[model samples]
Target: MLQDNFGRRFYYLRLSITDVCNFRCNYCLPDGYECDHDRDFLSLAEIKRLAAGFASMGTEKIRITGGEPALRKDLPDIIQACKQTNGIKTVAITSNGFKLAEHLPTWVDSGLDALNVSIDSFDPRQFQAITGKDKLDEILSGIDNGLSSGFTNIKINTVLMREYNAHDINSFFNYVKDKPVSLRFIELMQTGDNKDFYQQQHVSGQHIKNQLLANGWLPTIRHKAAGPAEVYAHPDYQGTIGLIMPYAKDFCDTCNRLRVSSLGKLHLCLFADEGLSLKEQLQIDDPLPLQRRIMSLLNDKQATHFLNEGFTGATKHLSMLGG
Candidate 1:
């Protein structure tokens, strides 16, 4: 198993298949995707090898992330590739849910175990304002389609921004009181280029957490391979709420995930300044060198991201890290 010197176990891998997203979210890519250099993302063969490498090291969960993962036409094939890996148990994807209702059937056939869709606001105009897209209705319909298609664990990700939708929590609560989906409220984080914007709009996840606790939402025991969200359940509600609060104290203590860029760089943490290029090792078509390299280098992984200290690291935007 891949265990850091700090004794934090690694069981999940968030792999960014591409950095191309169509949405122009205010916090992420407000101007839409701009190719800085040749985005020679990993090929299918390389992805297969990478999945195998992680599986060999006891990684059980692989989350496919991207600027918007569904943009790739061959996404079903990619999901199938990770699912076919011997030791990989759960294959999930995070997307903007661009055409999820249309594509979810094929994705389910390819063994996708879970889905997380980004929906920043419940109000259509506010959603359009935040995402630069007028597809909130379509995305919500896609989520409904997921429910009808047997997706019992569909998660809707909402970035909590003071200026955007933080105060409008009632809309989310009412929506979730009936649906069995999970609503995740993520705190607006400071990326390398978003310092000014972060200062202007950042909302602590604690704000929402406090409200939930007061409303009688009880924390749920997390599964061993779950991601970094602190989940909660309410007796009267069908859905659950999750809070991804990076700035919360002891947030990094349960670090169980590692990130890989679309170009094959291993980012030890989302806010890590440096990443080790595993591209050369990925080309060998063997899991040993890749596994060994990841296992060895993880000893240097930081015990904390130091997000509270205002360090945003090399990540210029959420899209760069597939957030």
Candidate 2:
């Protein structure tokens, strides 16, 4: 197992297949996605090697993320490669759900275990305003299609912001009350280019927690390989609620996940200042050299990120690093 200096053993990997997204979400890309320069993302063979190396080190859950992973026509192949890799127990994807309904079958056939669709607002008008996309209905429809097609339990990701969806928390609760979905309210995080926006729109996940508790939402136990979300359930509701409070006390205390940029660099934390390139070792099929480099990189993994101190590190865009 990959144990950092802080004694946190790693078990999850967030691997980015590409850095291109088609959304302009207010908190993330209000200006929409821009191409700073030409780039070459990882190939299928390279991704296979990377997953193998991590699995050899005891990583079990691999989440495929991107600016929008669906944009890649070969995403199913990517998912299949990771699923077929030894020691990988779960292969999931986080997408904008742009055209997920049209593409769900291929992914399921390739061994997709879970799906997370980003839907910030339940109202179509508000969703378009927040994400600059008029596809809320389509995305939700895609989710329904997946469920009807026998997909695993669905999870909807909503980024909580004072200006965007804070007032609509109850609306979210209503949406999930009748459905068997897990709705996660992620606290707005500060990034390199989003400092001013974060200041303007950040909402506390704790406040949401207070509301949930008052309403009788009971905290549930998290899976061993779960992401950093405090999940809750209620006897009166069919769905569950989760809060991802990054700025909360000891938020990173149970860090067991790591990220790999699309360009094949290892990120100890999403907000770390720089990434150590593993591209060189990725070219070879040997896991020894790759594992050694990863072991060396973990030595630099600190106890937690410096987000509270206003340091966004090398993360200007979560899409780029698959946060």
Candidate 3:
């Protein structure tokens, strides 16, 4: 196992296939954002080799992320490659659900084990305002399609902001109360592009928890998961609720994952800007050298990030870092 100095065994990998996205969410990406076509993204073969390497080192879970992973024509191929890797027990995707309906069947056939879709609000106007897209109905239909297509572990991710979609909390819970999907409310993080907005609208996860408690939602003890979300359930509801408060809560003590950008830079922490270039190391004909280098870098992983200290080291956009 890839154990860091702090004894955190790294087994989860959040791999970003591409930085290109279909929507310009107010907090994640800037408006009129254009992906640089000239930048080199990791090819399928490189991604497979790296994934296999990580699996060999005791990594069991891998979540494919992106500005929007479904935008890639070869996404199904990528999913299948990760799923087929030895020692990889789970393969999932975090998507915007823009073109999810069209690609859901292919993804399911490719051995997708779980899914998390980004849906900020139930109201059309608020949804459009949050995501800068007018396809609220399309996203809703995609959710239904995902359910009908047999995705059992589907989750809906909602980022809570004080001035934004925070008021939609009750409506969001009401909409998913009878559904088999879990609704996760994420606390806004201070990213390079959204720092100002985050400062202005950040909402504490404790407030959301209090609201749920007031609404008669009881906390439930659940099995430990790789992700950072604190989960809850109510007997009257068909699905559960989760809270991811990176800012309000210190989940770093339990951090057990690493992230690799689409361009092949390995990030030790989501808020950390410094990363090792695994793509450059992959050029060598021998795989052992690259694997050894990865292990060495893993040992140097920082115990925690400085987000709480208001540290912003790199100017790269959040999409480039991969969520």
- Residue 217 CA error for candidate 2 (Å)? 1.3
lDDT of 3 by residue, 1-323 (tens): 78889988888999998888878888887584576655588799888888888888888999999878887889999999999998999999998888667878789999999999888888889888988888889877887887876777889899888887887678887877789888899988887777789899898888878877887887766332368787888888888899988875557888878888888888888867676789866665466876788888887787787778887655356677556
Model 3: residue 279 alpha-carbon error in angstroms = 1.2
Residue pairs in clash, model 3? none
In model 1, which regions exceed 4 Å deviation? none
Q: Write the per-residue lDDT of candidate 2 for residues 1-323, one digit (tens) a residue.
A: 89999899999999998889999988788898897856788999999999999999999999999989999999999999999999999999999999888888889999999999999999999999988989998998898888777784689999998977898788999988878889999989999888889999988888889999998889999887899999999987888999999999999999999999888989999999898899999999888999999999999998879789988889997888767
Residue 254, model 1, lDDT: 97
Candidate 1 similarity to native, TM-score: 0.98
The local distance difference test score of each candidate is: 0.91, 0.90, 0.82
Q: What's the lDDT for candidate 2?
A: 0.90
TM agreement with the true structure for every prediction: 0.98, 0.98, 0.94
Kindly report which residue pairs in candidate 1 clash with one another: none
Please give the distance, in angstroms, between residue 108's alpha carbon in candidate 1 and its true position after superposition: 0.4
Off by over 4 Å in 3: 213-225, 284-286
Residue 236, model 3, lDDT: 87
Candidate 1 lDDT tens digits, 34-58: 9996989988989999999999988
